[model samples]
Target: MSKPNVLLIGTGGVGTIVAYGIDYAGKSSLSVVVRRDYPKVKDQGWEINSCNYGTIKGWKPAAVYESVSAAGEAGVTYDYVVISTKSLPDIVKPEVLAEPVITPGKTVVVLVQNGFDLGRPFIEKYPENVCLSGVSHIGSHNHNGVISHIQTDKAVISVFENPHLDKDFQVEKAKEFISLYSNDKNDVSYFEDTKWYRYRKLVYNATLNTVCALTGVDTGRLDLSGTLESVSIPAMREVVKIAKADGVELPEDVINTVVHSDDGDWFEPSMRVDVKKGNPIELEVILGNLLRVARELKVDTPVLSLLYELLKAVQFRLKEGQGLITVPEKRPISTKYYS
Candidate 1:
């Protein structure tokens, strides 16, 4: 089979990284879409560096469009749409989302976003087009326009499941991505009920991201044995509890699996980084969604509830004059630290 064409959206870490991955495949036709302000990235010519792959330079796309609308204006379509752009419903804007180069057999939108619900935004717009839920644990970031693959987790692509996934087509698409990512160490696991998996992953992320943001620790540092036993482990178990309560089946070994996996610590997540950069941390994404789901399922998240309360307190402190969300734990040597 011929290598399918892929158009990657989002210009942040994953966008650049996915560009590099597709380039490495050396088979797919790859195009990247960034915002108009970020058009300079096109001039730089993309490159990716990974501990696993060492350094790979020279990833010039067939073309780079400023926005999806621009790409649409130019009449560009792909067999696969890899949406790695984070900060969605904000970054991509409403106008460009689900605007199709997407049609059955014409395009399969592989929604590779974080924080779950890959099908949420798309189902409304392109009910007939395939929206396959996918997540990437690959830790690569654009450093001075260079894509660096620091680590990778299990990359999952969804079955069309919601509206457009014919079983045979889903299987074929899975194989295609498996072959695409096969060159790299990570494998593309396919799940039929992508939402539950996505939500389960969301619960996992709820802890990982909020704690990382609240404590201001890189995931890599905190996942160490002591932190794992203390903070990370307990937090994750809370997430697992929510998943089970909601009838989501999370593997017993997922935390172990993620930590031990190749790209285990892909550096600080976007929210933590946002906090450091003096931007609003993504408390809404991690906490809001999980809270909404918890309400829907009527699941108790006492530990998560505590985390949520603390996270809001921190956010309020940051905006309500202090302008910062401090670490989750109390200071090491303050009177309030212990008491």
Candidate 2:
């Protein structure tokens, strides 16, 4: 059998780590889709200082495309297109981003993003194509084109097939991508219920990410300051209630599991990091969508709601400060939320 041809989009920390795994597996031919950092990455290559995989220096991809359109112009029908982009639907819809490269019946679109409902657009747009949802538990960061990853424990990836196509074909495709990262340092598991796992992961992100970003602290500091009990735990409990209302039976100890997970105390979540860097955060997918579901189900999420509002303020401040978005001037007596 020939090696699978894969196109990995968004070469950030997660994307770079996944790309390294695929390269290590040697089972797939890898290409990347990058934007502003394209020239730097393509020229300088990738230098990964990893805890689990050791040092990976000067690694270049088989091909690099500036955009999905450029990749499409290459005329290659990829077997798998792995998306590790931030799930910011407000910025760009997932369907539109993947449109240029996805071959409806042939390509498997794997989503390695945070939050819920991220794969909906892709599955809806290409019902014939298999879509896989993956929840990643890896600690990594990218700075000045270099990636530093600290795998405190084995990074776990739980992948499940979306309800769109043949289950068998989807499972087979999911396993093919799983094989690319199932080494001694990484563990990959398959699940039948995608929503359950997505909600489960949200329990961690919805609480820790939100609280950390709001307080401008790291996981360790939050825990040390007793915010884990005063804030994080309550927020996670709200997530549990929301998940239960959504018909997903998360374990009763799910909050405990998330709170006690060995995320290095100093480790900053992607959202907090983005806030610190003045980059757009994945506020909607992580908290906004969950809050919407909570409101629809009439599930009380006062803590989550408050965190959502505060995080949104922080996001607005950062975006405006960075000049990514403009803040409208307000009249002295304006009563509206935005003016």
Candidate 3:
């Protein structure tokens, strides 16, 4: 039997480890779409230092393409097209990226990005294709072409439940992906209700990821600064309430667990990293969408609301810096109070 062909888009911290996992699983031949770092990755390859796979020097996927269109033009129908890009709907849509390579009913579109309801666009766009939602709990970062895997390596994948597709068939394909993505080094399991898992992840992202980005604080400093008790826990509790209002009942202990999950580590969450790097954070998918649910359900999220407003200000500056938006010049006004 021939190995399954897998194509991964986005080679960030999370994407790099996922690429490594697919390669390490050995059941699939991996291909990657490299954008900015195409020349470096295509020529010199990646250097991955994983806690699970140890040190793998000069690692490259089975194939590499410069763009999704280029990968689509290759004439190879991939079994899975894993999207690990940041979920920034304000910037780009996931379906736009996956549509080029998707083979309608054949290819399974797997979303490994963060944020709630991340698979909806893909499901709507590729109704004939199986859409799977993946929630990964891994601590990894990519600096240049070198990857550093620090903490946990566990992932849960489940079908997004598209009415247009067969449920049983989706389950089988999800299992196949698990088989190809799991090994002794890392853990990948099948989840029945992945949205619940995504909401559970929100307990961490909505609170720590958002707060740290605003305060410029890392996980370890958050504990020492007393913000963990004053702000973090309250924000997490609100997320839990919002999740319940949206029909997902996360455990009461989730807040405590997510709080101490990074007990002694001085790690910066993804959002904070983006802020430091002057990159547009995943504001919409991470907090914006979740807050929308809260509003419709009449769930009060003062902490999250305030955080969102502050972060929106930050995102405005980032967008302006990246030239995604242009700011009009200020106009002179005469007012008695101004004197």
Which predicted model would earn the best TM-score? 3
lDDT of 2 by residue, 218-264 (tens): 88899999997899998888888888898999998888788778466
TM-score of 1: 0.72
- For all candidates in order, the CA lDDT equals 0.65, 0.81, 0.88
- Cα TM-score per model: 0.72, 0.86, 0.89
Poorest 10 consecutive residues of model 3 by lDDT? Answer: 330-339
In candidate 3, stretches whose alpha carbon ends up further than 4 angstroms from where it belongs are 219-230, 265-267, 329-339
Q: Once superposed on the true structure, which residue ranges of model 2 sit more than 4 Å away at CA?
A: 152-161, 181-185, 219-230, 262-267, 328-339
Candidate 1 yields a Cα-based lDDT of 0.65
**Residue 163 in candidate 3, Cα distance off native in Å:** 2.6
RMSD of each: 7.3, 3.2, 3.2
TM-score of 3: 0.89
In order, how many clashes per candidate? 3, 1, 0
The Cα RMSD in angstroms, rounded to one decimal, for candidate 1 relative to the true structure is 7.3
Q: What is candidate 3's lDDT per residue for 117-172, written digit by digit as tens?
A: 77777878888888888888898987887889997689999988888877899999
After TM-score superposition, what is the CA distance of residue 222 in candidate 1 from its true location, in Å? 7.5
Q: Residue 231 of candidate 2: its Cα lDDT? A: 92
Which regions of candidate 1 deviate over 4 angstroms?
Answer: 1-4, 36-39, 52-54, 90-106, 152-154, 163-165, 184-200, 217-238, 251-270, 309-339
